[model samples]
Target: MEAIFALAVGIMAGAGIYLILRPRTFQVIIGLSLLAYAVNLFIFAMGRLRHGAPPVIDPRLGSDPALYTDPLPQALVLTAIVIGFATTALFLVVLLASRGLNGTDHVDGREPEDE
Candidate 1:
């Protein structure tokens, strides 16, 4: 499971980087989102992977610290998700306005010449 999760993160980060280098503004936005997702996954993974474990400690259970999952990473990831969403929305609004004013969605503000 860990290997699969790591592979997924690597793929997402790689794709995000590739898309970010593209000429289209929309693609860049999507790339940013993908990168954010990859980072969130990485941060979440830092909390350790455990099955059937509660996020919070149960008083009834002895405080061996292994009975519960780390909640810090979860909380951090949740916060990052909210912030990433807002950032993406803002980027979209800017993209639309730029497209409207320039009549193009290219990052360079002009369409590529036909070769």
Candidate 2:
């Protein structure tokens, strides 16, 4: 499972980087989103991957650290998700406005020349 998770993160990061290098603005947005997702996953993974673990210490349980999962990473990821959504929305708005004003969705606000 750890291997799979690592592979997934790696793939996402790679794809994000590839898309970020593209000339299209939409692709760049998507790339940024993917990169954000990858980072979130990486951050979340830092909290240790434990199945069936409670996020907080139970009063009945003697406050052993191993009994509960680290909640910090979870909270950080949650906040990041919210921020990412807002930023994505803002990016979309800017993209639309730029498109309307410049009549192009390319990063440079102009159509690409044919090679």
Candidate 3:
């Protein structure tokens, strides 16, 4: 399971970096989303993976460590997911506006002028 998560994180980072380097606004947006996903996953993974563990503590159990997942990572990831969504929305709106204003979605706008 750890290996699987590691693989996922690696793939997300690799794809995000590759897409971000593209000379198009859409690709950049995608890359940002991908990177955000990778980051969120990485943060959540710090809580440690467990099977069939409820995150909330049960007072009846007299403080059993194995009964609950780490709440800190869950909280952090939730906040990050919300922020990431807002960022992605903002980027999309900006991409649209820029395209409308300049009539192109490419990062550099017009092609280079040849001498």
Candidate 4:
């Protein structure tokens, strides 16, 4: 499971970097979203991967770190997911507006001519 998660994170980060380096505006937005997901996974992994562990500590368990998974990473990841979504939407809107004004999907204003 750990290996799988690590592989997923690596794949996402690699793909995100590749897409981010592309010339198209839409690809950059998608890359940003993928990067955000990779980051979220990295942060979540920092809290340690524990199966069947509750994030919230039970009162009866009496504040033992070993008994419960840390909730901080989970909370932060959740918040980041929401922020990433909003930023993706904003990026898409900006991309559309730029495309409309400049008449091209490329990052630069120049449109590629027909071959």
Question: TM-scores of all models?
Answer: 0.92, 0.92, 0.90, 0.91
Instruction: Please tell me which predicted candidate would have the highest lDDT against the true structure.
Output: 1
Rank order by lDDT, top first? 1, 2, 4, 3
lDDT of 4 by residue, 11-57 (tens): 99999999999989989999998999999999999999999889997
How well is each residue in 56-107 modelled by candidate 1, as lDDT tens digits?
8888887878789999999999999999999999999999999999999999
In terms of lDDT, the poorest run of 10 residues in model 2 is 54-63
lDDT on C-alpha atoms for all candidate structures: 0.95, 0.93, 0.90, 0.93
Residue 74's C-alpha lDDT in candidate 1? 97
lDDT (10s digit) by residue, model 2, range 1-115: 8999999899999999999999888999999999999999999999998888989888988789989999999999999999999999999999999999999998999987886
Instruction: Name the candidate, 1 or 3, with the larger lDDT value.
Output: 1
User: How well does candidate 4 score on lDDT at residue 35?
Assistant: 91
| TM-score quality measure for candidate 4 | 0.91
- Give me the displacement of residue 23 in model 2, in angstroms: 0.7
Per-residue lDDT of 44 in model 2? 93
- For model 4, what is the error of residue 97's alpha carbon versus the real structure, in angstroms, after optimal superposition? 0.2
- How well is each residue in 40-115 modelled by candidate 3, as lDDT tens digits? 9999899998777778887776578777889899999999999899989998998999899888888887545673
